[model samples]
Target chain A: MTAVRCVDLCKTYRQGEVDIKALDHVSIEIKEGGFVCLSAPSGGGKTTLLNAIGGLDKPDSGEVYIAGQRIDNLSKGELAELRLRQIGFVFQAFNLIPVLTARENVEFVMQVQGVPAGERQRLAHAILDEVGLAGLEDRRPADMSGGQQQRVAVARAIVSRPALVLADEPTANLDSKTADELMELFRELNDHHSTTFVIATHDKRVMGYAKRLVRMLDGRIVADIKQDAA
Target chain B: MNLVFRLAWRNLWRHPRRTWLTTAAMMFSNTLLVFMISLQFGMYGLMIDNTLQAFTGHLQIQAPGYKDDQKIRQTVADIVPLAESLRAELPSVSIAARGTAFALVSSEERSYGIAVFGVEPAYEPDVSTIPGLVSEGRFLGDIDAPEIIIGAALARNLRAGLGDELTVLGSGRDGSFAAAVVDIVGIFDSGIADVDRSITEIPLGLFQDVFFMDGSGHQIVINAGSIDGVAELQSKVGSLLPAGQDLVVHDWDALQPGLKQAIKADMSSAFLMYGILVILVAFSVLNTQLMSVLERTHEFGIVMSLGLTPGRLGRLVLLETAIMGALGLVLGAVLGGLVTSWFSVNGFAYPGMEELASKFNLPARFFPQVSPLTLLVGPAVVFLFTLLAAVYPALRLHRLQPVEAMRAV
Candidate 1:
């Protein structure tokens, strides 16, 4: 099954009287249980494409589908519901809600999905332990180190076992060892749970963990390559 | 809903100082509103009771035209018997019969035109404060005694003192020439210049004989314990009137038309000031909530991207404000009620209130009424306004673009 797909996506931004094409006629697809990395330099439209796929942003023109469901035409509330039920997202920074602890942040999506408190608590604890944050469940994001905060964000995204996970610069603020460990965790989750992973980054170390690599420049796809697991 | 509430509560304390400052503003305003409103109502109660009990009882049964025109001929016949019958029916009420006429009262050295009232001296104190305010000598005792009690200002004008003979001259109910020589038995200083200068009282029997009233009097005054019960008392008294008698029952409001108007005017002005205070507090809330929303723009975006609807996010903000408002309301009302209750028991007076009250024949100290309505009305209004103030900040959430919002620092 195709876990995610985009067809002829186009988006534009105006920077002080200059039109910048963030995504221009971009299109891609990832199959079920696929691990794909989108590589791009700064201002090269990777984040915009990820946002469009997650239904967090509307394209000036195109179609977005997740698990074979067209999402680009959905309303804001509908998109939120779709994201809550089907997709999980991890941003580069400021990921966890400041007022919530690590466990609570991990349980946020399931709680919104109306999961029973006991079940949510059980799942949140298990995910925190899996992310190597066993004893830091009660710590707020501000009290955690950069690597730990990113781990918490990653735990929150995949804790509910979503079919697809979209991560933008997931290792940008992490040290080298922490980044490698995080990539290994992502790979383990992808292989064990059959959860499709889409990560946007320019880091060669992060791209090495992907089964497929897609390169972009000036909002247009420039290369598509398949490789064995790192 | 529990998670939302928890999130909202936790968010409120993110900046504890701002939350506390905003809550304090609401608390202070609510407390002031409670106290001032209660005090105003209390002062109004005093004003009404003082003015009514001073002379005009809470309700008066008078000849149809007598209230509008104090003509001697327009009198309630057998007033004393009627009042005695009412007193028997309503044991709790105080009843008195009176006859009024404009007469020339002359002392040995001077004379003046004054309104002389013929009162049932024994029952007069029950319905009026004037008899209790006698400053000199004694009130009239003998039912038919040729004696009178004049106000100090009236005595001063007529140059009369206790035991002095005064000549009372007036027209009778039959339009005949009425004249008599009466001795001054008492003098009262009511502190109200108009009443003191213009009013005099004599024994009802003596007045009947001297004025040829023929068993008739002008008014049957009744005091029904409190102003709150006056409406029911008026209805009761109106129904009890002898059939076919051309009499009307006038409540204090009817007898004193200016009183209600004065209370309404004062209330309008006071509420305007209260409205200003509530609005000021609401603006303070607006400032705090707006800053809170602006500061957390990125967090809100992340939450939105996490599948939390904008409507839900807006509701969360409002919930936070509501929690803050509830705190202010409960705390402020408790504090205000405590302060007002103390004053209600001990009485409150401003500087020089005693002297001012003495000059106007009013109570020296005022009590603030601390009923639930007074305690809650102000705080409830403030709570609603604070919620309204949070609306602008909550609406800003709907305008957020999650992609752009996550980009905010």
Candidate 2:
């Protein structure tokens, strides 16, 4: 089943008198459990496309689907509900709430979801352990290193066991080894839990870990290639 | 639910100085308001009490047209019985029968037109301050003593002293020539210029006899309790009056119509000053909350992106405001109460206030009321205004688009 499908997505950004097309007639589909990388250089629309798929941005003209439900025309509230329940997002910078510790950050979404405190705590602990942050659950984002903060952000995004995780340059601030470790964790979640991932990155090392790679140039897809299983 | 609280509380300390500055503004303003309001009420209480004590004793029972027409003949019929009945029915009150006459008081070389009150010596001190304010010599002697207590200023004007003979001349109740020769038993300085210059008190029996009335007196004055209790006490006194006696009750405000207007005007000006202080504190809160929201744009975007709704984020900001407001309100009220109580106990007085107070026979010290309403009303208003000030900033989050806010630096 299709986890995410965007048909002819179009988005534009205006700077003073000039209009820049961030996404133009971009179309893509990812099946459940698919590990895909959206590879693009600066000004090539990867972040815009990721934001559109996560319902964080509304495309000027497009139809977005997660698990076969049309999402383009949904109200802001409905879109928030869809993102809260079905999708998780990891941003490149400023991913974790500064005031929340690793464990509390993981529990943030579940708290909003009205999960009981005990259950939320249990899930938060388990997710932090899975992300190799068990001993650092109480450390706020500011106290953690860049890589650790990213890991905490990743844990928070995936803690609720959402079906699709959309990440925009998730490993941008991390060292090489930390980036490799994070990719390995993403692959594990995809293989073991059937959780699909759509990562937007410009890093060539990141593209190598994807089972499917989509490359874009000036907002249009130039290549969609499926490689051997990682 | 607990996590939300944790988030809101911890978020406040992120910039401790800013939070404290905002909270301090509210606290300081609330403190000033509480202190000022309490002191104002206290001074007003003294002002009203002293003003009323000059002649009116909170409430008075008089013949139907006596207040409108101060003719000596418009006396409450059977005033002694009526005063006795009031005293019996309301034992908590100070009731006194009075006969009043505008007469010529001549002593030595001075002959001054004075308002003479014929009062019961025993009950006069209970209902009026003139008896207690005797600056030299003494107040009028027992109910039948042929003596009068004139104000100190009157004494100065008359150049009279204790045991000096003073002549009183007035038209009698039946329009006959009423005259008397009395000794100056005491002189009072009631702080009030009018009372000091043109008033004297003699025993009711001597006054009625000298003024040619057999048994009638002009008024039966009663001091029930504090001014706050006057309405209820007035009603109680009205019920106790024997029906169809041609006697009616009048509260101090009705007897002195200008007094209520003076209080209203004074309070209006005071509240205007207090209102300005509150508004300044509110704007201070607005500045703090807006800065907080603006600086947290990226953090808010991250939360919203993580599936927390914008509405929930807005509410979280409001929760933050409420927490801060509650803190300021509690601290401010407590501090304000403490300071007011300290001042209330010690009493506050300005340099020239003593001289002004002495005129009305008022005490030099002003005590703050320090009641629950006075303490809470100011802080409650500040809390509400702080919340109101925060609403714009909190609601500003509702218009925040997660994608754009995420991109904000």
Candidate 3:
């Protein structure tokens, strides 16, 4: 089943009477539980497409659907509810609350969603273990390695069992070795939990882990590639 | 909602220095405001209590026309029969009758102007404590002996001591020039400079002879059986008295306009100071909260993006402010109470300006007392101020757009 679809989506940035088209007439669909990568060079509008699909930005004109709901038609609050129930996000910046420990950062999403305290703790600890951060539960983001922080961010994003995970340059700040490890963790979660993953990245290593790849340039998709298991 | 509160608490502790400094500023202002107001009230209370109890005795009564005519001899007839009737009418009351006249008191070397009070020594002790404040000599023994008691200042001015002869000359009620030789039997100090330097008390017969006054007293001092029962008793006394008679029955508040005016002015001044302190504390809290909110713009956006609703964020900000306010106010109340009690017990004293002190007419030792409301008011005021401060931050939280805030960097 298709979990996300964009029909001729357009996004523009205005800078003092000049309009820069970040995404123009772009359209794509991702199946449920699919591990997909949106690959493009710098300024190719991959991030803009991810931001629009994640409900963090509005398209200038077009349609976006997530889980059979018309996302562009939804109000901000409704989009927020949809994100809370069905979407998880990992950023290139590892946007963890600096004051919270590794496990607490993961538990924060469940907390905001009003999960019971005990259940949130239990699930947060479980996700941290799944992300191979089993014993570093109390270490803050600043105290962790780049790879560990990214894993913690991933654990936080997935702790609520979200149906779709959107990762923007998840490995952009990591060493090649750490980047490889993070991709392996993503691959593990995808295979084990059947979690659908949507990654917007220029990193070849990140796109290498995806089972399906869509290539973009100048705000429009140029190619779609699918891979079969060995 | 609990999660919002928990997040707010954690956020507060995230920057401990800012949190503590803001709380300290509010706490200091709260303590200062409460202490100043309570001390002012306490000093006012002590002055009123002492003045009413020791000097004025709560209320005074006078013949209908006599207050306007305090001269030793006036046209109003002697009202002794009416006075005795009042005594019977209010038997449980403390009452004294006195006649007042101006006279020249001389002791051979010097003569000074004096206010002569004519009183039945036996009945005077129940009203004012003039007899109790004597530092030297003794009170009048009998009406026929024609003895007088002078204030310490007057005694010094005339160079007269106990048993010294003093001459009093004044006009009699019948317009004759009256003169008498009297013994200075006592010297009393009532702490009021005007009263201490000029008042001289003589036996009623001596005053009546010197001024040739009628038999009735010019002024009547009355104390109800209980302070609480005064209103009812005054009404009863009024009903028993003759209508159209020239008399004045005044309560304690009416007796001393100076003291009442001072208290009112001090209370208003304290109220104004408290208002300014509240505003200052509110601004301090608001400034700190606004800074923190602006700094955490990106964090708030991230939380919002993670499904933390704007309402939840707004609640979180309010909850944090309230918690800080409650803690700061609690500390202020306890500290303020301690300071109030310390001042109340020790009493601040001024020693240098004896004349100025007397001129201002306030007591040398100022004792500040605490009311129950004094301790409670500081915390209530701080809480109110803090809540007002939270309004801006709470609004900022509610209006935050998740996408824009996340992009704030």
Candidate 4:
């Protein structure tokens, strides 16, 4: 099954009297349980494409589908519901809610989904353990290191076992070893749970972990290549 | 809802100093409102009681048109018997019969025109304070005693004193020449210049004989326990009157027309000041909540992107404000109530209050009327205003674009 698809997406932004095309006629498809990496330089439109796919932003003209459900035409509330139920997102920085503990941050989505407290607590603990943050569940984001905070954000993203995960520069603030460990965790989750992964990055180390690599320049796709796992 | 509440409560403490400062403003305003409202009401009660009890009793049964015009012929016939019947029916009330006429009283050296009231000597003290306020000599003794008690100012004007002989001259009810020689038995200094300079009292029987009243009197004054029960007492007195009698029962407010209007005007001005205070506190709340919302733009964006609706986020903001408002209300009311209750028991007096009170026949200290209404009404208004103040901040969430909000630093 095709887990995510975009057809002829176009988006434009105005920067003080100049029109910048963030996305131009971009089209891509990712199959179920696929690990794909979108590689680009700074301001290369990778984050914009990820935002469009997650329904966090709308294209000027396009069709976006998640798990075969068209989402580009959804209302803000409807988009929020879709993201809560079907997709998980991890941003580069300021991910976790500062007021919540690590475990509570991980449980936020399920709690909004009306999960029972006991069940939410159980799932949140399990996800924290899986992310190598078992005993640090009670620490707030401010109290944790950058790597640990990113791990908490990653735990929160996949805690509900969403069918698709969209991550934008998830390892940007991490050290080299932490970035490699995070990529390994993403690969392990993808292989074990059949969860489709779409990561936007420019790092060669991150692109090496993908089964498929798509390259972009200035909002247009320039290359598509398939490779074996790292 | 529990999760929302939990998040809202935790978020309020993110900046503990700001929260406390806002809460303190609300608390201080609420406390001031409670105490001031209570004290104002208490002062009003004292004013009404003092004004009413000084001369005009809580209620009076008078001949129709007699209050507006003091014509001697317009009289309540058999007022003594009527007062006796009313006293029997309302055992808790003080009842007395009286007749009033404008008379020229002449002493050995001088003479002046004064309003002379004929009062039941036995029951006069029960209904009026004038008998108790005698400064010299004694009140009238026998039912038919040809004696009178004059105010100090009136005595000073007539050059009269206790035991002096005075000639009372007035027109009788039958339009005949009324004249008598009466001995002054008492003099009272009521501290009110108008009442003291223009009023005197004589025995009801003597007034009847001198004024040709023929068993008719001008008014039957009744003093209930307090001003609070005046309306009910008036109604009871109205119902008990004879069906054919042309008499009217007037409560203290009815008899003193300017009194109610004066109180209403004072209240309007007081509430205007109170309104300003409440609005000031509301603006403080607005400032705090607005700053809080602006500071957490990115966090709000993250929560919105996580599937929390803008409506829910707005409700969370209001919830935080409500928690803060509730804290102010409870703590302020408790503290205010304590302070007001102490004053209510011990009485409160300001500087020079004794001297000022002595000039008007008023009590030196005032007690605050601390009831539940006085305590809660002010705090409830503050709580509502604070909630209203939070609305603009809450509505700002609906306009947020998650993509843009997440981009905020």
TM-score of chain B of each: 0.96, 0.93, 0.80, 0.95
How well is each residue in B1-409 modelled by candidate 2, as lDDT tens digits?
5999999999999999999988998889888988999998888888788778766889998888889888888888777777888788889889999999999999978999999889989888889877888878877767888899888888888888888999999999999999999999887876677878888889998988888878889989988667878999988888887777767889998998887787799899998888888889989988988999999998888888877787898889889999999999998999999999999999999899888777645688889999998999999998988889989998898898898898888
> Fraction of true contacts kept, per model?
0.87, 0.72, 0.55, 0.62
lDDT by residue for model 1 (A54-142), tens? 99999999899998899999999999999888888887883888888998898888988999999999999999999999999999999
Q: List the residue pairs that clash in candidate 4.
A: none
Question: Chain B, model 2, TM-score against the native?
Answer: 0.93
Candidate 1's residue-wise lDDT over B1-409, tens digit each?
5767778899999899999999999888888888998998888888888888888989999998778878889989988899889989889989999999999989999989999899998999988999888999998897789999999988888887999999999999999999989999999988888988999999999888888999999999888767987899899989889998889999999999998898899899999999999999999999999999998998888999999899988998999999999999998999899988999999999898999877645689989988999999999999999999999999999999888887787
Q: Each candidate's chain A: what TM-score? A: 0.98, 0.98, 0.96, 0.98
Q: How well is candidate 3 docked (DockQ)?
A: 0.44
Indicate which candidate wins on TM-score. 1
The deviation in Å at residue B115 for candidate 4 is 2.6
TM-score of each: 0.95, 0.94, 0.77, 0.92
Instruction: Extract clashing residue pairs from model 3.
Output: B42-B369, B63-B246, B64-B246, B64-B247, B65-B246, B172-B211, B173-B212
Candidate whose DockQ is highest: 1
Q: What is the lDDT of residue A145 in candidate 1?
A: 95
TM-score for the A chain of candidate 1: 0.98
Candidate 3 runs further than 4 Å off: A71-78, A176-181, A184-194, B1-10, B13-15, B58-129, B139-184, B197-251, B254-258, B274-278, B350-357
Residue ranges of candidate 1 with Cα displaced over 4 Å = none
lDDT of the structure predicted as candidate 2: 0.88
Please, what are the lDDT tens digits per residue for candidate 4 over residues A1-230?
99999999999999999999989999999999999999999878999999999998999998999989999999988998988888888888948988889988988788889999999999999999998998999999999999899999989889999999999988889999999999999999999999999999998999999999999999999998999979
How big is the positional error of residue B304 in model 4, measured in Å on the Cα after superposition? 1.5
